[model samples]
Target chain A: AQRVTQPEKLLSVFKGAPVELKCNYSYSGSPELFWYVQYSRQRLQLLLRHISRESIKGFTADLNKGETSFHLKKPFAQEEDSAMYYCALSADRGSTLGRLYFGRGTQLTVWP
Target chain B: DARVTQTPRDKVTEMGQEVTMRCQPILGHNTVFWYRQTMMQGLELLAYFRNRAPLDDSGMPKDRFSAEMPDATLATLKIQPSEPRDSAVYFCASGTGTGTNNEQFFGPGTRLTVL
Candidate 1:
């Protein structure tokens, strides 16, 4: 079975400190990984995707196939960066195409 | 800007009542997805449609839940005889469905409460 795991339910960091939100997945085939963020009173939006290999809001995630991980990281955490983050995976297969499997999510808090 | 839209931002109903949630996908999007979000379960895909056809509904409960896309622009998820356990935020998303570019755009979501 395909699954995405975000072990930490809450991650707290001081402002300007580095932050890492761990995410791991178990899949038999190649998977598309994404990080979605939901800020307070705002709708969920895509933060970044592994396929893009680009950073969003100073956050970057590298897909490690060998480790089965796609941990999201930021060099300096900001108060505005605090939000609920979810790691998601999608595998293209018949009947399952366009379906996304999401992790339980992590609530990141940046304390000033 | 293009975005998926859902109706009834919030709903409160009693048990055994019928609940219907609607979604309008972003124009030109080929795929629409329904997801249930809860604190415990996180996000779970309920159903999805491609090109206005029912592709898969295995994630939904067959006995009381039904999902349909009346057209390319409109999709609906209906739960008959809703239970307290069914209370959650329902999110609708749209995507191009093209390989390697299948990023989904989610709607505001409908918050449902069952008494």
Candidate 2:
């Protein structure tokens, strides 16, 4: 079975502190990984994908095949960065588009 | 900016009532999806459509849950004889997946409550 796991349900850090949200997955083959964020009163939005390798809102995630992890990290946390973050995975096959499997989200709180 | 849109931002009904939620995917988006989000379950995919055709609805309950794309721009999910377990936020997302990433754009979800 394919599954995405966000080990931490809540993570807190002070402003300007470094933060990491851990995510791990279980899949047989190479699966596409993505991070989605949902802020208070806002809709869920895509943060970044493993393939893009682009940093969004100063956050970047590196897929570690050896560890089966795709942890999201930020050098400096900001108060505005507080939100519910979800790690998602989709099989590399053509079924990845609208059928993403999401992990139980982690709530990040960046306090000032 | 292009975005997916859903109607009836909140709905409250009695048990065994029929509930209908509507969505309008981005203009050119070919793939539309319906997802349910709850504090307990987090997020679960209910159904999806490609090119206005139903692709997979295996995630949805067969007896009471149904999804349809009546036209190019409109997609609807209906539940007959809804149960309390069905009370959750239903999200509509759309995207084009032929490209590199299968990033989906989500709409403000519909919050459903059953009494």
Clashes of 1: 0
Interface RMSD of each: 1.5, 2.3
Provide the lDDT at B89 for model 1: 94
Residues forming the 10-long window of minimal summed lDDT in candidate 2 chain B: B95-104
Docking quality of model 1: it rates as: medium
Each candidate structure's TM-score, on Cα atoms with residue i matched to residue i, is 0.95, 0.93
**Which residue pairs clash in candidate 2?**
none
Q: Write down the lDDT that model 1 would get.
A: 0.91
Residue lDDT tens for model 2, A65-97: 989999999999999999999998876665554
Tell me the spans in candidate 2 whose CA falls farther than 4 Å from its real position.
A94-98
What is candidate 2's TM-score against the reference?
Answer: 0.93
Model 1 lDDT per residue over B1-115, tens place: 9888999899999999999999999999988999998988888888888899888888899999999998898999999989999999999999986435778999999999999
Alpha carbon deviation, residue B77, candidate 1 (Å): 0.9
